[model samples]
Target: MPKSPETLLEQEFGLIAELVHAHARARPRHPALIDECSRVDFGELDQRMDRVATSLQRDLVDVGDAIAICAAASVNYGVVFLGALRAGVAVAPLSPSSTAESLATMLADCRAKFLFLDEHVAKTMATVALPSGLQLVRLDHSPGVRSLEAWLAPAGSVPVPVTIEPDAAFNIIYSSGTTGTPKGIVQPHSMRWAHVRRARNFGYDNEAVTLCSTPLYSNTTLVSFFPAIAGGGTVVLMPKFEAGKFLELSQRYRVTHAMLVPVQYQRLMDREDFDRCDLSSYRMKFCTSAPFSAALKADILRRWPGGLIEYYGMTEGGGTCMLLAHQFPDKLHTVGQPVTGHDIRLIDEQGRPVPVGSIGEVVGRSAAMMKGYFNQPDKTAEAEWYDAEGKRFIRTGDVGRFDADGFLTLMDRRKDMIISGGFNIYPSDLEAVLFQHPAVRDGAVVGVPSREWGETPIAFVVLRPGATASADDIKQWTNSRLGKTQRLSAVELTTELPRNSIGKVLKRELRDRYAQASS
Candidate 1:
């Protein structure tokens, strides 16, 4: 019999792939992964993983070498990721939505020996100059290409086992950089183990079913993905997010757990048939990645069926704060308290710790932090902060203050803070007021160059459908509710705001557009 989940996790460090294989031994017939096309049970899933590992070994891919995957989420993708882990290879999951250049840069940055992709991603990457000696394996069947099915070793193949240490590189998740090549964040096995162990508190077990709406490249998706398998649960992967499809699958699979960003929640709530969907099976719903508004939290609490949790932290693994929205309705504005064993503090511009209630840059230290930025020691050093006691913490680049009750209220990203007439302004504060306008469907605030104040705030408004609100009318109304320093210089009407795949408003894009228009 396989070891129990709790016993395996009780070790100093554990391998995710080993834990998954253990589950296969314990419950071979149980469903382990579900994608749009097929369902894979634990028994078959384990065999597939072994075949992938054995094939990599045959290719002479050594332990700790990296491989890259650039495809939509699918059963084969999951197997490749797990199999690489079993062979002690770190998987670099690249985003398909990234520009071809950016995608190529990431593949090169990780020093991958193989690039696993689907026909769709292959067409997009046709223009990319692939690194020399990098093998291409198609996840889907393509007549002329090397396919994953053909690449796999014979049935019953078993790879030579290897040890995975606490500090061994597990995966390299790249930052969402729009400009040059994004830096790869190297997360270790110990860090992922910490996430899996902490996930036990959220009720992941053999019976748990997790629905993942985000792409596999994102850490947002993996946080829930790894935990489900480690706990012997079933994971349902979506090719792309459609609110209606998500609701349908949630009810179809009786999904018990989910990790979603805030905008996804907004879309789900806005669906005309939302109230009709049977979401009563959800045990817990998680939100992260961007600022989750208090209003949205309350809306979900009033209408949604399960406990809602909002996590506040960075992908680099710093201090984390979690707000159990169901338990603290009155404290909806704050992002709850720092999680257990995470030391989160605020520091001024000069790196001094701020006073108890003062707003400063958020810095945190935790057992789950990343190893460092891959191949970029200087960039890694720039993201670190050492306390007076010489302990290291990752800088979160956010400005926030702690309330008397220890809850954190985020102000803004330190880089996003606008200086108007020598006074500081948080765009979130202005955006909150903009959201209050009845005719506003979506909005954002950005600072533009101004000769008078050095910089002045401008508003971008997406008016509600069929609403006859002019930019001037919205600006007048917004300014009427604001102080002199916070008033907008202009309000430009737009159909929608540009956002990244995970729903963070692309403020840099908005700022650049405004600058070019003014010029």
Candidate 2:
């Protein structure tokens, strides 16, 4: 008999593959993964994982070796990701949105022996020179290309099991940035285990149906993906997230849990047919990755079913804050309190802890923190801050203040803060004022170099459809509400703001655009 899910999770060092295999044996007929084209049961998933591991071993890919995958979300992608874990090999899931040059650089950075990608990514990478001797496996079937089915071992093949340490690399999630070579964050098995352990708190179980609409390469998707499987739940993967299609799949699968970013929720809420969809089966919904507005949270609470949760943290794994939005409607403006066992502290520039209710940089230490940046020790060191007592914490780069009730109110990124005539101006405060304008649909505030004030604020506004509002009209309305130091110098109208794959506004891109236009 296989060990129980509780037993495996409680172990000092447990492999994710072990838990998955146990579920396979205990409930062979239960659905484990569901994508658009296929539905895989735990038993079939287990056997396929074994075949993948065996094939990798046959290829001389030893334990601790890394492989790179760039593809759209699919059952095949999930199989390869889980199968590599079974073989004690780490996976680096690269973004298909990255430039061909970036893809080549990341493949080289992780020293991957195999590159598994789809036709789309293959076309993108056709011009880039890959490392010599690196094998290429096509995730989707293509004539003359090595397909995953061809690469996998025979169905009955069993892989040689290897012990996985708690600290071993599970996956390296490259940082989400719009430009430059992104650093690969080396997440360990232990960090993922922490997420799995916490999944129960959000009601994950065998009956749970989790809908994952985000790309598999993002950490936002994995945080919910691993837990659903570990708890023997079914996961529905969406290749592309269209608001209508997402609602259709949710009702079809009776999805109980979903992890989505704020923008996705915004789109869903804005849809006309959202209320008609059968979302009553939903037990819990999660939001993260970007700033979730208080108004949006309130709207969700009023109309959406089930409990709502908002998580605040980084992929690098430091401290985490959770806002049980349904329970604390009054605290919607805050990011809730520090999660249990997560040590979150506000520190000044000199590394001293800030006084009560004061704003400072957020740093946190937890059992789930990452090992470091892969092959970039100096960059990793720069991301870490050691306390006076010698405990290390990941620097969050966000400035925030804790209220008397312990909820954290984020101001802005420490680097994004505008210093005008020695007065600090938080863009969020300005953006909040801009959001109040009925004509403003979306907005972002950025700081640009100024001749008189050293640095001045500029507002980028996306107006509502059919709303007749000039740049000057919006600017005057917003400036009237903001403090003198926080007023915008100019306002620019745009169709949309640049955002990363995940929903963070690319402020650096906005600033650069401003400079180009001024020049």
TM-score of each: 0.82, 0.82
Stretches of model 2 off by over 4 angstroms after superposition: 176-179, 416-519
lDDT of 1 at 422: 34
User: Model 1 — TM-score against the truth?
Assistant: 0.82
Candidate 1 structure quality by residue, lDDT tens digits, 155-220? 999999898788888999987422244689999999889999989899898999999988898888
After superposition, candidate 1 runs with Cα above 4 Å error: 416-519
- Per-residue lDDT, model 2, residue 437, is 94
Clashes of each: 0, 0
Clashes by residue pair, model 1:
none
lDDT for each candidate structure:
0.87, 0.88
